[model samples]
Target: MRLSDYTRLLALAAIWGASFLFMRITVPEFGAINSAFLRVFFGFVGLAVILLALRCPIRFNGKFRACFTLGMINSGVPFVMYCIAAQWLPAGYSAVLNATTPLMGALIGFTFFAEKLTLSKWAAVILGAVGIAIITTFGEAHSMQELVFGGLACLVATSCYAVSGFLTRQWINNQGGLDPKIVAFGSQIGATTLLLPLFIFTSTTDTSIHWAQGEVWASIIALGVICTACAYIVFFRLISDIGPLRSMTVTFLIPPFAILWGYVVLDEAISQGFIFGSLIVAVAVWLIVRPAKQAEEVKALQS
Candidate 1:
């Protein structure tokens, strides 16, 4: 990867790491559905402005439906799931759970995409599951139910991410490929569309939404404009420049930044279990995603 690619990767990680903080701030006031809907709604608006500013035509090349469906899987569902998790899990805990995305990807690939699962990869999967169990069992929560549901919500979000990655490849990337910006914009449209009815329902039904706070709106805008809109643009560029494997390294870098932000900004306490579990997950992810040539060399040496 070029130096510029590395810089973009770190910037994307920082931006995304901060997204959990934003969600933590917004979900309580807006509720999960409303917070999620407003995020994509503003994300759509921000990306539209970006396209217009760049004079980029908004064409999906007959792939709008696919992009929309991808949005539901990738953006809409995952966003809501994470928001639900934010209600109970600390931002740091949620971020650590999200580190399991590649594990989920590996499992989904083996099961559904006919991808290979070597012995090492199977060990990685089992180790990743153990790491998740450790985090969920030990992480702080209001109750056991909250801890279980919160952890499960994050895993569900990551699974959606895994599915969407493949779908993006099959539907968008492999099928003549759309511009990343256009794909990002269209996906936000899809997310917004999917969440609108749920947002409306929650707005009508939930009496606890605290809409009068200015900081909540500020966090929401940052979540939409910076985290979703700008981060997607940079992430797509990284994929274009360095390929997905290298781009995936951003996953490894997010947790420390998230943990730091949680500690510094929110004053959340870090426990020994979080530290140990995060390390285990990180190691498991490396085992799963380490380059094929490197894995081959290690096996050859052992043989």
Candidate 2:
């Protein structure tokens, strides 16, 4: 990979890593559904502005359904899942779980996309499973019940991301690749549509809403504009430059930054189980990422 690509990867990891911090800050004040709605809603606004400035046609480029599906699975579902998780898990905990994306991606490839699973990948999966076990069983957290539910939510969210990665290669990249702005904008639009009613219902019913707090508002804008919108653009560029397989390496780098942010911003302490589990998950991602030489071939398999 080129130095610039490496820089983009690290930068993407940092932004996404901080998403956990932002969510942790905002979700409690606004509640999960409302917070997630704000995220996609603002993400749509940010991407729309970028699309206008770039003069990229906001209209679909022959793949409307695909873009919408990608958004619903990738952004809509996962955002809500993570928001719910943020209610219980610390930022670093959720970030480490995010590293499971490649593991889930590899599993999806092997099962549905006819990709070969090397022995290393099998070992990686086992290691990842073991890492998750250690984290869930032994990690430092307040409540075991909350930890279990939070961990499960994070897993489901990453699985959605893994599916979206494959779908992006199939539905978008193979069709000569949509402009990154279009994909980002369309996805956020789809997410916003899915979230709007939920946001409204929660706003009406949830008495805990704290729309007036400065921290709450700041985290909301940062989560949507910077983390979701800008991160998507950067991620799509990395996929264009380095292919999706290599683009996924960002997951491995996210946890440290997340742990750092948690420690500094939230005063969350790191435990040995968290450290060990995180290392194992990183190894699993590295192993899965190593053999993905052709992303399109793996993602778009014929029956």
Candidate 3:
């Protein structure tokens, strides 16, 4: 990767890593529904502005179903799930739980999409699940039942993300090289539309439109513009250059960074189990990406 690419990687990591912190802090002030609604609302506006500034074609040729479907899976449902889960689960733990996306993605691919799941992939998935269980089991045990429930919420979020991957592959990828900016644009709008009722009904009681603190506004803007809009741009660029597996390596590091940010900002405790589980999760990512590396090498050799 070039220096520019490295820069993009760091920026992407920072933007995404900080999103967990933002969600953790901001969700309490604004209810999850409001926070999620605003994030998507501002994200839509930010992307729309960028599209206009860059003179990118924003034309929608009536592929609303495909785009809207992906929006719900890729953005709408997962965002709401993550937001709700963030209420009960620690941000760092939520981030760690998300590290399971590739494993879940692999399973979804194999089961539904006819992608090959080799022995290595299955082994990696098992190890990753155990790693997550370690963290889930070890965290704040007011009751074992609560921990289990929290853990299940995280798993549900991961599954949402995983299924979204297949949705993206089948719907977006097959659409004659559709511009991802378009997808981003569409997804945000779709999410905003879906959240409209919740915003209207629930937000009236639990949410405040007034920004009491500048930090809150900053966090909201950062989540929308930097994390959502700019981060997606960097993400698609990385995927274009490095392929999805390499690009998605960000997932492994995100939890650690989220944990680190939480510690620095919120004085969140980092347990031994969290550390051990993180290491195991890292190993699982290495295992999953190994085949993608091999595939890239083979392609280079053939070329």
**Which lDDT tens digits does candidate 1 get at residues 165-271?**
77777787778888999888888989999999999898999887768999999999999999999888787666556655456667777888888888898998877
lDDT for 10 (candidate 2) = 90
Q: State each model's CA lDDT, in order.
A: 0.86, 0.86, 0.74
| Predictions: Cα RMSD each | 2.9, 3.0, 3.2
Higher-scoring candidate on TM-score, 2 or 3: 2
What's the residue-level lDDT of 164 in candidate 2?
Answer: 84
Q: Taking the tens digit of each residue's C-alpha lDDT, what string does model 3 give over 1-303? A: 578766777777667778888888777677777778778888889999999999998865666677676666666767677777667667687788777777777777788777676678889898998898888777744566766776777677667666765666556565554677877788788888898788788767753456587787788888888888777767655655654545656666688678878889977776788778877887887788664567865865686
How well does candidate 3 match the true structure in TM-score terms?
0.87
TM-score of 2: 0.94
Residues 117-179, model 2: lDDT tens digits:
877889999999988887877677678888888999999998888888878888889888887
Candidate 1 Cα errors over 4 Å, as ranges: 240-246, 294-303
| TM-score of each model, in listed order | 0.94, 0.94, 0.87
Query: Candidate 1: minimum summed lDDT over ten consecutive residues — where?
Result: 237-246
